[model samples]
Target: MTILQPQVGHETLELLTNVLIGNGFSIGISSQFNYSSLVELCDLNIIDKKLFEELETSNFEFVMKTLVNADKLDKIYNRTDSTFLHAYGRIKRSLIEAIGKIHPEKYEIDLSDNYVLNKTMVRHSKRIFSTNYDMLLYWMILEDKKHVDFFGRSHNKDGTLRFTPNRESEKQVFHLHGALHLYLNDGYIEKLNTSDHLANHSSIVELIKEMIELGRMPLFISEGNGEEKKKSILNNEYLNFCYKSLEDLEGSITVFGHSLDNEVDSHIIHALNNAKKLSRVNYCIYTEGKSEPVIQLEMSRITYLFSGKEVVFYDSESIRNNMRVIEFYV
Candidate 1:
C-alpha cells in the first residue's frame, strides 16, 4: 500500500524536459503563444548551460510570511500584468502541455500504473493531496476517467475531508489552499468555466495593474512568519483531514516536489512522524543529486524530531534515466 505523492515543480520539469526533447518536440515552438520564456528556460537547461544559484538565504518562513501578507503580493502584482499567481499557474499549465505534447502515452501509462493499478492490487485506496493551485492534476486524472474521493461531504470550514480515489462517489479532494481555477464569489468557492482561458484579454493584467496603482496585494510568498496558520491554512477542515490521513494505515508515502517549508504544514510532518511509530513509514524524497543538500537539510530537521521510523533518500539521477513510476509497484 505505498502512497506516492510527486511534487510538480522545477525538479519535475527538469526530468520532463529531457523526456520531451528526447521525443522530438520543437525546441522553440512558434505556434505556442508566450512560449519564449518557456523555450528559453527549457533550452538553457537542456543544453547543459550553467544556471545561476538561487538566493540560498531564502527559507520557508520567509516565503510563508509573504503568502500570509497578501498585501505584499498585491503590490508586486499591481505593477506587472503578470501576478505571481498568474505566473505560477502559467508554469503549471506549460509543464503539463509540454509533457502531454511529447510523450502523452508514456505520461498516461505512468500515472495509471503508479496510482490506480497499485491501489487496486494492494487493496488500499489511493488518495492525492496537493497544494498546487493549478488544474494540471485534474486534467491528467480526468483523462484517465478517475475522480478523487474527498473525505467528507461537509462544506463547513471545521469539517474534515478524507478521500479514497476508489470511493470517489463518496468523497473528493479537499483543496486546503485556494485553487487557481476556483474563484471566490459571495464567500463561496466556485469553479471557473473551462472556456475562460483569458487568452491575451489582459483583464487580469489590467486589473492587477490598477491594483498596483492603488497599492494592492501580491499573490505569492516572498518572505515572513506563516502566522495565518490558525484561521486560514490550519483551519478546522485542514487539521482534521490531516489527522484522519495520518491515522490511515497506508504503507510508505512518497513525497515528491513539496518543500515542506511551511510552518503551518508542520502538522503534516507531525502526522508522518506519528504514522512511522505505528508502522514502517519510508520516505522517497526525489531531487536532482545537485539539489540534495536542501532536501537533506529538511530531512535532517524532520528526522531529528521523528526517529521512530526509517527515512530513505532516493536521488533522481539514480532513477531518472531508467525510471518509470510504475516500476515501484511491480
Candidate 2:
C-alpha cells in the first residue's frame, strides 16, 4: 500500500512504533518483569508491605500509577510525607537495574537485520516517533551512516547531548517514552551520548553498565491507565513535546506496529483524532493468520474515533515481509 499526503509537497510520512514493532529483537516487555528486587532495593517491607505486593506482580508503570494515587490521597489529607515520595526513587533505580539485566547486549544483536530495517524506514518515513525503550530502533537508525546525528550532537550545560531532531538529516527517530540509554534528572530528559564513542559491542556494554552505576533509569510512562499515562507524559518536558507534536500531525499518518489498544492507549487514539488536517490514517494491524475478536474491536474503535476521515488497514506481516520498505506515493 502506497501512502500519499493530501498536500502536494509533503513527501516522507509520519511513522510511529511501539514495543511490538516486529517479532522483535529486543526483549520487548512481554516477558514477565520481576519487581521483587525493586521492593528489596527500596526496603518497602517496613514502609508499606501492601504497596510492595501490588507492585511485585506488576511493572514499574503500574507501580507508578499506584504511587500517583497515593500522592493524591496524601494531598486530600493535607499531609506531605517525604518518605512515600522517596520510595519511588529507590524503586526507580531497581527498575532500571532490571531493564539493564533484561535487555539484549549489543553483541547479541543481528546487525544485518538492523541494516535492512534501517533501509526500510528511510524509504518510508523521515520523522519516526517510537515508544520503545530498547536500542533496536536506535541501532537501526545508526545503520544509516550519514544520519547518526538523529539524537543531535550539541551538548547542553549538564554535560549531556541535546536531543534536537535534525529534520534536514531525515530519518529522525524520537523516543516518546524514553530509552534504556536515556535518564531523567531535575525534570530534564538526557541521552547517553553513545553515538560517538560506540566503536564496538564491548564499549556499548561498558557504557550501559557505567550509566546504571550512576543511578539513571529510562524516562518512561509508569502508569497503568491512559489518563495516568497522559498525566505523566504531560509532566515531562520531552514527552509533552512529542505528544503535542503528534496531536498536531496533518495529512497522511501511518501508525505502524502499534496495537492502538483502547484500554491503555486511549491517549494515542485521542492524539490522532486531534490532528485536524488528518486526511487519511494508514493503521497497521498485526495479524498472525486470521483476525481475532480483540483485533476486530480495536479496528472498530479506531474507525469510530475518526468517523469523518478515511482509514486504511494493512496487514503488519505484509509490511514485515516487504523488509520494512513501505511504498509511499507523494
Candidate 3:
C-alpha cells in the first residue's frame, strides 16, 4: 500500500480541482451517509422494530437477498411462507418510508453549499451515478433545476403524462441503484413527481405507503451480492439501461462516499474496469482520523480494480469544502 497525500495549498490540488471543473467526469455516490440515515430512522421507529432487528442481526442487503430468493423459490415449497412474504413486503415498505423520512428534501436550503457543488459538477460532468436508494441527488437536481436532466416522463400536447423514449441529454443523472422516487407502473419505470402538491418528505412517505397499498413495490436493487444485483439489473429494464450507461461511460470518473466493497460493489468495479476510455480515476478519500496505511489500502484496492488506469487519491475535504453536507444529512 502506498500513501500519496496532496495538501490543500499544493499546486497539485489546485490543478486537480481545476481539471475536474473543466473536463467531463462521472460521479459515483454510494451508501455512506444514507446507510447511517437508515439506521437512525430505525432507531426513531420509522422502520418497524422487528424488521430493524432483522437488519441488525443480518445485514440489510442480506435480508433483501433472502427475501427475494425466497420469493423466487416459494413455489417449490421452500421454507418461505405467506407470512414471510408478507413480512418481507412490510420490510420493503418500511425501508422506503425510512428513506423518505430521512431524505434531503427539506434540507436543500441547509445544504445550499452542497447543492452548489453538485450543480457545478453537473455543469461540467456528463453523468452522475448514485448507488443510494435515497432521493438526495434527485432533490438536489430538482432544487437546482439547471443543466441536469432527469429524462423522465413528459407531457404531450394533449395534457396527459406519457413516457418518452430515447430522449438524449448531455447532463443526465442515473440512479444505478433504484431510487425512492422511481416506481414500477405497468412494466415500466416512471419517476414520481415531487413538485405536485408541494410534496415534502413525509408526503412522499405517504405516497409510497399508498403505492404499497395499491400493490406496487418501489423498484430498488438491495441484493447482498454483486452477482445478484447484476441479475436484478438485467431483469429490470431501467436498471439494465443504467448498467449499460455505466459500461458506456468514457473519460474520467470521480468516486466519493463509496467504500468499494468487493462483495456488494463488484458491478462498479466491473464497469470501471470495462470503461476503456477512462483516462484517470480520482478517488476522494475522507481521511479524518484514518491512518496512512488505511488510506493506502483503500487507494491500492481501487488501483487494483482499475489496473492500468491513472489513479489519484486526494483528500475529500479539499476537493469539496462542503464535506458535512455530503457526509451527513443537514
Candidate 4:
C-alpha cells in the first residue's frame, strides 16, 4: 500500500500541480491567474504598485518576508511608518482575493474522468497528505462525495472539524500545509466546511475571501526552509500532527509532487529518515529527456537523502494525471 504524500518543491511547483504559479516554472495558467494578473490586482486594489514592483517576485512567501523585514527595519531605525503595514494589509487582502479568483468553480472542471483519478491517485493509498494551500484537492474530495472518509469526523466544540485521528478511520486526508478554509482561533485550528458555505456565503471561494477580509488569514506556511516551516507548523496542533505523521509509516510510500529538498524541506527529510520501518519509496520524477543532467543531479540529492533505503524513481506521468486538479479540465 502506498501512502501518498504530495508536496510542492522549493521552486517551479514541480509536484505536477501548479495551483499557485511557481517562480521560474513553465506553468500553464490563464491570463487571470498569472503574475501580471497579480500586478493588476495590486493596481486595481489601490495597493502601491511601486511597493509591489520593489518586491521583485510574484511568490507571496517572498513578498511576505520582504514586508516583514520592512516592518522590522522601521522599528530598528526608530521610524514611524505605516506605509509598509498598510501595503502589507492590502497585499494580504489581494493575495486572498487572487486565490479566490484563481480557484476553479466545480462546474469549471470536467469531473467526468474522476474515476481514472481515483483509481490511480486515491484507491491504493493508505493515507493522503497534501501540502497545497488551495482548494483544488479539497474540490477533488467534494467530487468523490466521500468527504466523510477523506476528512475525519472529529469536530471541536465550535463545529470545526478537528484533526483528531481515530482507529476506525483507515482513510484520511491531511492538509499538511493548511488550506484557505483553515484558520487559527484560540490556539486551535478550525476548518471551515460546506456548512459555512451554505449558511453565509455563495461558495467556498467567497467564504474564504470573506474570512480573509475579516482578518482570518488561513494558516498558510510559505516559509523558505524546513526549519522555518517547522517553526510555523509547531505553532498549530493540526499542522504539527501532519508533519509528524511522515515518520510513522512502515511500508512503501509514494512521494508525489514533492522534491523534499534537504534545505527547503529538511524537516520532512528528517522525518523520513526516522521512519526506520519504511522499506521502500516510489519517488516520482519528471522525464529527463532534455533535462537529463539536471534530473540526475536531483536524483543524486534524493539518493543521498534516502541512503540505505530502497528508493525507486518513476515517471512524473503517474501523478501528473492527478494534477488534473486544475488545468486538465480546461
Candidate 5:
C-alpha cells in the first residue's frame, strides 16, 4: 500500500474545534452559554440578564484557556457542580459537531468521489475504533457499500444488543461510547433514525433549551458503579467484537480524531497492545500541541504494557491530503 499524508490547515482545524464545541454545548456537556450555545441562547435570553456580561466573558475565557484544566475553569464557577455541568456541556457539544461537520467541504479538502474512494480504502482497514458518538463514518461506509462492524451501544441502555446487520468479514469500525442519535430509556437503545434529523433537527434549539433548564444531569450514562461497569465491552457484544477483531487482524492499528480521554477506553488500547497479530501501532493525532499530557499518556500506557510495539504521532494536516492518493498497501 502506498503511503498518503494529508496536511490539515489552520482554518480547517478551527472549524473542527468550533464544531466539537458547538455539538458539546447542544448535548449539555458544556455550559448552555458556551460559545456556540451563546450564539443561540444569547439572542433568546436563555442566559440571565444580570449574568450576561459574566457569561459572555467567561465564554471568551473558556475559549482562551482551551478548558484543558480545572483551575482555569474554576475561575468561572464557585462549585464543582457548576464546573462539571458547564465543561461537560461544552465538551458534549464540541464532540457532536466534530463528528458531524468534519469533511472536505468544510475543510477545503477535495472530497470528491475519487477522494472519498481513496479514503474509504484506508478505512476498509482492519480493526478500527472510534470514541465518537456521531454516525458519519457509518454513513460513509454505507454509501460506499463497504462493510465495517460497529462495536458500540446500539442504544445507550443495558440488556440491549448493539449489532450492525449485514457486516462483511474484512473490515470493522467500533464505537466505544454510546452514539448521540441513539437513546436508551427503558432497557432499550432506540435509534432516532432520520436522514434530516440526524444532521439538522428543526427543534434542536427547543430541545437544547429544555435540556439546559433541566439542570446538571447525566443523560449520557446511568449513575452508580454497577451501571457503569455494565457499559464496558467485556460485557457488551458490540465492543467485544472490536476486541476480537483487533486480536485477529494481522497488521498495525491506526487511530485518528480520538483524544484518549477516558479510562474505560484505555481498555481498547491495552487490548490492542496485547494483540498477537499486531506488532506496532500508529497514532495520528489532530495537533502537535497535545504532545505532553494527552498523547504522552497514550504512549506511556502502550509502552509500559507492550514495550516491543511503537507509538508514532502525525500532524492531522500532513495526513489530510494523503486521502486524495491513498493506495492502501496495508
Candidate 6:
C-alpha cells in the first residue's frame, strides 16, 4: 500500500472539516503529545525526583495495583508506610489540580476565537468520546451548551443525582476514562455541578483533595496495562457506558490526538471492528516533522486495524491551522 501524504491543502482540509460537521460521525480524543503540559505539571508536582526514579525502576502496573488493591494482596506486601497509597493520592491530586487550573474561565478570552471551532465541529457529531480526565471537552460543551448534551449522569426532582443514559440528544459527549468532576456517591457515579463550588468556597482541586484525605479516591482510571485498563472500564458503570456507546456507534469515527498504543487501545480497535454500521475510519496523525518511514509505519498500523474499511488519514497540524482560521471567522 502506498503511504498517504498529509492533508495540507485547503480543499482536502475543507472536505474533512465538512465530514466532521456532518451528523452520524463520532470522535475519539486521547491524551497524546498535546497533553505534555499536563504531564509536565504532574511530573513536577506529583512525582519527586527520587520517587520518579523509584517508579521508573518498578513495574507501573504492579505499583498501581498495589496502591489501589493492597487489601487483596498478601499481608507481607502491605508495609506500614503505605508508600504506594500515598503516591497514588499525590498523583490523583496533581491530576485534579492540573485540570482545575485550566478551568473554562481561564480561557474565556481565547474561547471566542479558539472554542468556536470546537463548538461548531462537535455540534453535529453523534457522540464525542474522550480517554482523558481533563475538562477541555467539558469546557467546550459549556461553550456550546445549547447544542451539546453529555451522557452518564443527571439530577432528579428530589435533588439527587442519578446515572441514567440519555440518547435523545443529537450531540452527546462520553468520558470513557472518567472525568475530574465525577465522583462516586451512594454507590453510583454522580457529576459535581460547577455551581456547587461557590457555596463552600471550595475549588475542584479542594474537593478532590478532601476526597483523598477522607480515603475516597477520585474515579479516574490511569491503569498502566491495556488489559488492566479494559478491566477497570468494565468494572465501572460510567466507563462501561462510554465503552458500549463507542461499540454501538454507527457510521464513521474520527480519532484525534490518540497514539492508539496497541496495548492500551485494543478495546478501541475491537469496537471499530465490531461496530455494526461503521464503514470508514479516519485517523489524524500528528507527525511533528518525523521522517516518512516513521509516518508510514504509524499509518500501516491503523490500516491493519481497519483492514476492510475505507481508511482515511489527516494531518493534525493541517486540522489545527484550519481550525485557527475558522476560529477567527466564527
Overall local distance difference test of candidate 5? 0.40
| TM-scores vs. true structure, each candidate | 0.43, 0.68, 0.69, 0.68, 0.46, 0.69
Each prediction's number of clashing residue pairs = 14, 1, 0, 1, 27, 0
What is the RMSD of candidate 3? 7.5
Residues 1-330 of candidate 2 have per-residue lDDT tens digits of 322222222222333321123223232222322232333444344555476565543345456557667778888899877565566666655555555665566555555564454446544555566665666666656555544333444655545665564435544455666566666655556666665556553656456655555554456553356665677788767777777777766666766656566766777777778778767777767556555776777777778877778987765444544543342332
Which ranges in model 6 have alpha carbons more than 4 Å from their true place? Answer: 1-120, 147-160, 202-207, 214-216, 325-330
Worst 10 residues of 5 by lDDT: 17-26
- Tens-digit lDDT track for model 1 on 1-330? 122333433333222211100000111111222232222333223212121113221222232233335446677667544344443334334333442333222233434433333222112214444444333444444444443524332554533232222333322343434333333333333343323433543433333233333322222211223344323444434334534554453455444344455474554555566664334433444444436567667668646654676554443333332234433432
Model 4 lDDT per residue over 1-330, tens place:
122434423211323221111211112112323332444654334445555455444445456557778889999998897777787787777777667665665455434453244333443344666655666556656655533322344564555664554434555566766777777666566667786455866778878778767656677665456776777777777777776666676666667657676787787777777888877766766563646677777777788898968876765554555445433432
- Which ranges of candidate 1 are over 4 A from the true structure? 1-125, 149-174, 193-227, 234-249, 262-264, 274-278, 286-299, 317-330
Q: Which candidate, 2 or 3, would have the higher lDDT against the true structure?
A: 3
- Alpha carbon lDDT at 68, candidate 5: 37
lDDT of 6 by residue, 65-109 (tens): 456675345347655666556666676566556555543332333
Candidate 4 C-alpha error for residue 325, in Å: 18
What are the runs in model 5 whose C-alpha is more than 4 Å off?
1-127, 150-167, 183-231, 261-264, 285-305, 312-315, 327-330
- Candidate 4 has an lDDT of 0.58
What is the overall TM-score of model 5 with all chains considered together?
0.46
Clashes of 2: 1
**Of models 1 and 4, which has the larger lDDT?**
4
lDDT (Cα) of model 1: 0.36
